[model samples]
Target: TNTTKELTYSEAMYLCGYLNGAKKENRDLTITEREIRRRRSAVLKRVQRIGIDTTDWGAVNAFFLDVRIAGKKFRELDGEELLLLIPKLESILKKKEDGGY
Candidate 1:
């Protein structure tokens, strides 16, 4: 019956082409996203060690918005945004430890 119907040659070729391209998507993105999250977590942990209340969501959001070039929320940040934010956070951390903040 219907289940036994064979795909036409062009239909089969199209499906194969779609699968070949789709299968390779997200592999690089997933790795980059994981690395970004890891670096973000490490920066936050260092902030916590300096006595900033990382638990308070509003303050965290405010800090991110203030320091971020794009003013994006924490979760909305991608690698490019995070790359820009990390250096600023690290600078503040260093200044705090040096009694500058």
Candidate 2:
């Protein structure tokens, strides 16, 4: 069976802090998570081209965790962290385009 739980406003606010560089509980996935997922995919596609197995979540999470300053898992990164991470990811892509990856 499939079920879902809705978020409370307080939880949304907490996600605000959590995403904006403050520590807080990650109650659920939100729009920012989707954006993070997209960014991760872009990186991993390049990673795969460099011959790393994208199927291994361990390596994937490690790469993302290293990209941002926080979050044990990539999914836990919030908006502020995302802002920091985007440039880094783009830079990596740019360098790789020049055959550095």
Candidate 3:
């Protein structure tokens, strides 16, 4: 059975708004965002595998503060900010491995 039901005016408007919002959201993310997310994910995975204590607020805050990242929270960082953060995170991880934490 392939019966079709036409949408009401309000339903149509709601659908349109939902679709437009989705499109706008996708359009808002440029290539830089994608790249930054990719890099950030990789860095986080590596850090986790290396057993860095990401849950340690003091350490994480110190790292972000030292690197001059405006936000103390990693999830709040934007794409360009993540780009700057990844290398600093790696360096911090390296220092930790070398008993510098």
Identify the leading candidate in terms of TM-score.
1
Candidate 2 lDDT by residue in tens digits, 18-46 = 77866533334555577677766665566
Ranking by lDDT: 1, 3, 2
> Model 3 over residues 1-101: C-alpha lDDT tens digits?
23225777776776776877745555566555678779778756655655656777566546455545445566666677766766776786788889996
List TM-scores for all candidates, in order.
0.60, 0.42, 0.46
- Per-residue lDDT over 1-101 for candidate 1, one digit per residue giving the tens place of the 0 to 100 score: 14325878776766676776734355577777789988778767765766768999776677667643347567777767666666776787788889998
List ranges where model 2 is wrong by over 4 Å: 1-54, 67-71
- Cα lDDT of model 1 overall? 0.70
Report lDDT per candidate.
Answer: 0.70, 0.62, 0.64
TM-score between model 3 and native? 0.46
Clashing pairs in 2: 19-78, 19-79
Q: Would you list the rank order by TM-score, best first?
A: 1, 3, 2
**Backbone clash count, each prediction separately:** 0, 2, 0
Best by lDDT: 1
Clashing pairs in 3: none
